[model samples]
Target: MSGADIANVCNEAALIAARHNEESVKLHDFEQAIERVIAGLEKKNKLLSPEEKKVVAYHEAGHAICGWYLEHADPLLKVSIVPRGQGALGYAQYLPPDIFLYTTKKLMDRMTMALGGRVSEELHFSSVTSGF
Candidate 1:
């Protein structure tokens, strides 16, 4: 099965679980979904090439670093270079305990942090990819 197919299956499962009024979907379910996608990618031999992997790593690392540098930005939760069902080459996840109204400066800072990955990739590699 393709990564997208596995993701769709996971989405359907989550939807069904939610509709059934389950108290909470287990974390194991999410892990299973991720594993399925990763396995599919592996079977397809679509694992990123070395250069692409480095690009993805640096791109994700930029987001985490920039977010950490910003005063009002959330803390970095995780960063991954693995391709997911959502078709993303990488992702940088953050955790903000609370959402509060933002000042203009804060909003700009947030936007800057959000764009940090693309900017860094371009700056470092002298090129940009569709993945960005």
Candidate 2:
């Protein structure tokens, strides 16, 4: 990460810790900060129709399922259909493997994991939604 990125994380994590009345910036605070940085803040007030909500839930669940079953895919940390950042309708956080290098199989597994959401939508709804 760059110097600015590290600084941003520290500032955000400290704010999160303070909001929670913690003595120090904790690991979870850092994690939340990182997520906020990467995904933007959770947009809890965003409204979705029931049908859209169902679709988003299914899409995220598809990601979780694929990640869980794929040997080289990262393990899931959490899944949510709650709108996040500017455009994310749903997300599945994974405890990614620490290694930097990716083998061919691992790369393919990652690609499959990414496609899980759309594949799920196709399987359940019989149609794929636009965008990633």
Candidate 3:
């Protein structure tokens, strides 16, 4: 779906939630909505191939490894290459402790950690793959 379509759906969901006497929609509610949308999309049989799965595994591994290496970053909870209900080929789930605030350095470090996978792929494979 397009960004506009997602935005429209989110707006509608917010309206619906509000009409139900919800003071404010939480992040988890929006996340669940997104997951439902993705599940619907996957039911249409749009799944990634083996190569794509490998790339995702590598990408997620990068995130896991980076997070594992950082002291303040979240701990790696799990990493999987198996396709889930939402059609994600892979994912790196983290267990983040309470994050009250973020500093500039912390933000930059997070950004760098996210980029670790792409950088690792480029450095080792010498050929970058697009699905990431």
Q: Highest lDDT among the candidates is held by which one?
A: 2
Full ranking by lDDT: 2, 1, 3
Which tens-of-lDDT digit does each residue in 78-99 have in candidate 1? 7777676556777876766565
Please list the residue runs of candidate 2 whose C-alpha ends up more than 4 Å from where it truly belongs after superposition. 1-3, 20-23, 98-100
Q: What is the C-alpha lDDT of each candidate?
A: 0.72, 0.87, 0.66
Best by TM-score: 2
lDDT of 3 by residue, 1-132 (tens): 589869956975686567668888767556545544543323335466776766777777787888878765767766656555544555666665577798777777677777877875776565876533
Name the 10 consecutive residues with the lowest summed lDDT in model 1. Answer: 36-45
Total backbone clashes of model 1? 0
Q: How far in Å is the alpha carbon of 107 misplaced in model 3?
A: 1.7
Backbone clash total for model 2 is: 0
- Answer with 2 or 3, whichever has the higher TM-score: 2
Alpha-carbon TM-score of each model against the true structure: 0.63, 0.80, 0.55
| Poorest 10 consecutive residues by lDDT, candidate 3 | 35-44
Candidate 2 residue lDDT tens string, 1-132: 679998999999999999999999889999889888767888878888998898899899988999999999988988878788878998999887679899999999989999999999999996778623
